[model samples]
Target: MALKRSSSMKTQLVNGIQLQEFEQEEEINTSSSNNTPSEPAEAKAHTEPKYYTVEEAVETIGFGRFHVLLFVIMGSANIVEAMEIMLLAVVSPEIRCEWRLEDWQVALVSTMVFLGFMVFGVLCGYVADKYGRWKVVFGGFIWASYFSLLTSFSPSYGWFIFLRCMVGCGVAATSQGFILKTEFIPAKHRAFLLPLASIFWMLGSMLIIVLGMTVVPSMGWRWMIRFSIIPSIILIGLFLFIPESARFQVSAGNIKGAMSTLDWIARMNGVPLPEGELREPEVTERGNAFTLISPAYRRTSFLLWYTWFVASFIYYGSVLSSSELLEKNLLCVTDADAEHQIKHNHEEALCYCIPFNMADYQTLLISCLGEVALIPLNIALLNVFGRKASMAILLVLCAIFFMLVNICTTMFGFTVLLFLLRSVVSMNFNVVYIYTAEVYPTSVRSIGMGFCTSFSRVGGMIAPFIAQVLMSRSVIWAMSPFAAACVICAIGVVFMPIETRGRALLQHG
Candidate 1:
């Protein structure tokens, strides 16, 4: 009986142990079944990268040392360009004297440069948009520098026109820097920084004025042309230091290169990269001159183009006209006998060879200072009134000032009017520049600028006809059209559909 009871106990214990083992196996299987479906998803959630846009990345990086460095490097291009354009004003008379040319012929030298600028403007912008801004920019530096150096040794009037026209072609490439800068800069900082860029332009303008005062009188215009190459050479050597536009890189679908640039900007700015990969647009709009005038951008394009035309017409008109106005005021004495002598030998009496005296440089320098001084005003106007209103207001003011120039009787009064016109016109230029850059998408920004600027060159081409040619006949004739154009531009600006006051730059149309 005891043996049977012990056997029964052993059987029960084995049954319990078997039961526990089966339950444990069932639990394990259940857990595996539940987790198996979710494993890939969890892993993906943990390991997948975040995506960022160009503006987002730039916003995270913030404005810092990188931007400051960019401004100096890119702004140097502005200085060189300004000097080149201003050189035309300074040396036109010198070339006229050397070539024994008439006022109209002297005007052609200025006209030819704009012709080159206009002809190549769209092509360079297209190349920049399609290929890259950096290539067009630095390549242009080399091209412009080569042609400019050759221009110094120009043997005759024909060669001089051809070389300088090529120089304009090269100079046309330099405007890409502004587009490059617009791409990189955060929207919040554009108003202050962009208008501030005019400082470099003002510096170049004044620098050439100083050089014109010191160099041209002694060393001649050829030496002045030679001196202009120095900036290009320096920028070319520093080209490696300046990175290509990362915004441009992304738009071009160069994800790897764009990432590399962002890394550099992040490292240079001393910031961490925002989590995630840089996002590229699925379909990039390869921009051309046709894209610029497409139905979507057609209205804005036409208005902007016309604005650029008149703004340039009036700006260069004001610049070129200032020389004529100042020459008349300074050289033509107020004394009746002296005035009579001037009128009698007006062609011979005007100092074409050395038109600007020391006083003229001082006055010109002061007027240029107005561009820098009113920068704060431009910023405020841009921020407060927005682009369209500021442009219209400034344009109207510019016209009034242009008309006012006709009434000035004294040199001081004339200088003051010149200062007002320059300052207001410069403000208009800054507004239009910022407005155009903001309105266009990344794909078409450079091309759009090139197109609009080409029209500006058209105005530039015609400006000499008025400023140099018409001013020779009558100041009233010269000044009236400038005022009228300003009025026309103000009306057109008011009708502009887009006011890019605080807008993000679009990546594609």
Candidate 2:
């Protein structure tokens, strides 16, 4: 009876153990089935990012009415900026005559603008990258237009200088505007399209000349400045139409905003996103203008800044000194009697004179006209020789012209050589803008440009004093430094390791 009871207990215990093993196996299978598709799909949905690059966005958005409208409206800002720069030249003569201001004081008024650029350029750039490109555009234009208009009403030289300085501080948006345009353009078309902005710059300067010929002589430089605001006021209202950079929005982790921008771009471009979703561009950690100095970027960053300084030194140095250049040429053209006869008709006397001195407005107009050829030349040179070759060659050409300005003795020779010099230097300036934008990554593009431009403003601030001191001795003294600068920058271009031609914009430096 005891053996029979023990056998029944053992059978029951084994059956219970087997049942427990079977239930455990069934539960594991059920969990695996539930997780394999359901959890993995959910995890992937959660982990994968949606983002796009500038090039991809360009492909989707393309060059169409959207681009035309945006860039056109944006070009208005460039026009405003150009007018501000040339305005110093336009008003300097009148201010000098009216205030009985010394040559140094006239130069100081111009120098103050660049000084403001030196102070505020990097700050504006940082703000553009940290905040938004459109904000920089609007902010710059608003500051520039308001102060510029107020400048026309200045009661004294001190007030005029301060207001003009504010305009320079505001016009630092040139770098921001350049980057903003680049971020939207397609890679294949970038080099060609980017130079088109120069045309608007040219037009803005030419507008000042038109004012000089028509209104400036009759009314005054003040009225000309006030009249210049009409277009700017119109442009400010249109700022609402330009879109913020989708690339910037994405890097900022604003996915919804990026998407909304991308949708508008895609709708205009008539293309779908890659794999039905955008993927974030791979980038290093986010940083400020100083980030450009990191080990990876140090060589390129310093190189660009130095080159920009050199270019600005030569370009703005030449521009700011242009008023005096005409005076030098006039020495050979007019005797005491001719000068006496023309004193009353001086404005009308040179209105159409071939051998006459190039007035400040005329000099500025000639400078602007030079940009008309920059676009086509940029297309050919950038496409054929690549960025390095084009920039180096252009700088060399500029150097040759600067040397000619010193060598030439006659009025015709000075005028022709000076015109050519302005043209070549303008081309070089456009090249620098294109190259700077191409080299830096979107991560710090605007600030990087601003940093480089800020250094250029350093050169600009010193340019007037240098030109003033040098011109008193001889034109050669003023121009020699710029010739040396051109040579130095030309050499720098040869040493650059990267050529950004036909490549997508770098995501980060």
Q: Highest TM-score, which number? A: 1
Candidate 1 has what TM-score?
A: 0.90
For each candidate, what TM-score against the reference? 0.90, 0.83
- How much lDDT does each candidate structure score? 0.84, 0.74
168, model 1: CA deviation in Å?
0.7
Model 2 lDDT per residue over 431-465, tens place:
78888888888778888888888999888877877
What is residue 348's positional error in candidate 1, in angstroms?
9.0
- Give the Å shift of residue 85 in candidate 1: 0.8
Tell me the lDDT of model 1 at 265: 92
Give the clashing pairs for model 2: 51-278, 51-279
